[model samples]
Target: MLVFELVCNGTVNDILHGGNKAPLKLDLRLIIAAESAQGLAYLHSQAHMKIWHGSFQPANILLDQNFMPKIAGFGISRLITEDKEHTCNVIGDLSYMDPVYLETGLLTLKSDVYSFGVVILELISRNKPTHSVNNRLVRRFLEVHKEGKKATELFDKEIAVTMADLEILDCLAVIAVECLNLDVDQRPTMTDVAERLLMLNRSRRSQAV
Candidate 1:
């Protein structure tokens, strides 16, 4: 028999959009992104063996009473060595899965980066990955970013209310876009993503003080 500890606060999705009308504040969002990035970074680099989270999505991200997140749904994960992309049957949600993996049927650590990037986008917009014109939160952000513009309209208005908040949101958007690059080689490592997110959180909190 197996057991799982129930997360009191439910998933990040439940907290933010599961019939809860209250706003998901900027501070909490930053904490979630920072902590989640660090957690994934560990699986990618700090773990004794590299682990691929074949199903990294918002729904799998469980939150405790304190709203701290835990990554779940590891039944499909695989172990990999240095710079190797595991080949397996197509798995994971289309909206969050890496396109490269879909196209090549090869999963790399960067594929996880792609999924995390979608999670970051969700944290920013409060929009489900399936929401939007092209049914992809990533495409909208990329289009806006490529035009050298901020996708403020795509953000959760509650969090992006002020100029300061928008600045922080834009920084996150930059990180998400970087993770979402089509060229797997161009994607930053989870280590880099974690550091950037951690630094952003620290910088924002310092300014708020």
Candidate 2:
């Protein structure tokens, strides 16, 4: 039997739920989100057989001692055999589920993209996607942006002070908006999203240095 090393930092969900001594900082959250996107990019592109992470959520994502993100739980993954319909009715976490996939049984790459968008929202808002009080976070964020509200106000209080780059935050928010588009066909491919995020991450690092 083969064994894998345990990740030290634990799930992103845990850290968000006061698991850590202090709240996660802004740069750290962005880094983790970017890393998670890279992981998804690899899984979507490098595999000989396409694997759909069926369930991509903060709880399903793990972090290492270095705070690197790793996607786990492939047990529910559906290997795309052909362009045919998959009869499996796998339902992921409700909050992170793609609305299109929820209505239709078809699971596609875009489904993962939608779930990733939710994760991005969570990182920005520091709130759970399924929070009953504010379930339509993405919609509200977009509304607030359109209304000329300060975008930084949407971010968690912990990292509010460090959020100087409103442009970058706006870009990220726009990307998330595209990802969460109601029409799956309108969403950017994981490859495209990964490349864009990689550039963003590099830019952020350069600015930090």
The digit string of per-residue lDDT tens for model 2 on 1-209 reads 99987898888988887545466777788888788888888887887866788788998889888888889976557454437445357466878887777777777778899999888888877877763434677667767757867567777766666546555676677788789888888999888888888888788788889
* C-alpha root-mean-square deviation, each candidate: 2.4, 2.4
What tens digits encode model 1's per-residue C-alpha lDDT throughout 34-120? 998899999989899888886788888899888899998886674444566656577668888888888787877899899999999
Q: Which ten residues in a row have the lowest lDDT in candidate 1?
A: 78-87
C-alpha TM-score for every candidate = 0.91, 0.88
Span of ten consecutive residues with least summed lDDT in model 2: 78-87
Clashes (N, CA, C under 3 Å) per candidate: 0, 0
Q: What local lDDT does model 1 show for residue 180?
A: 91
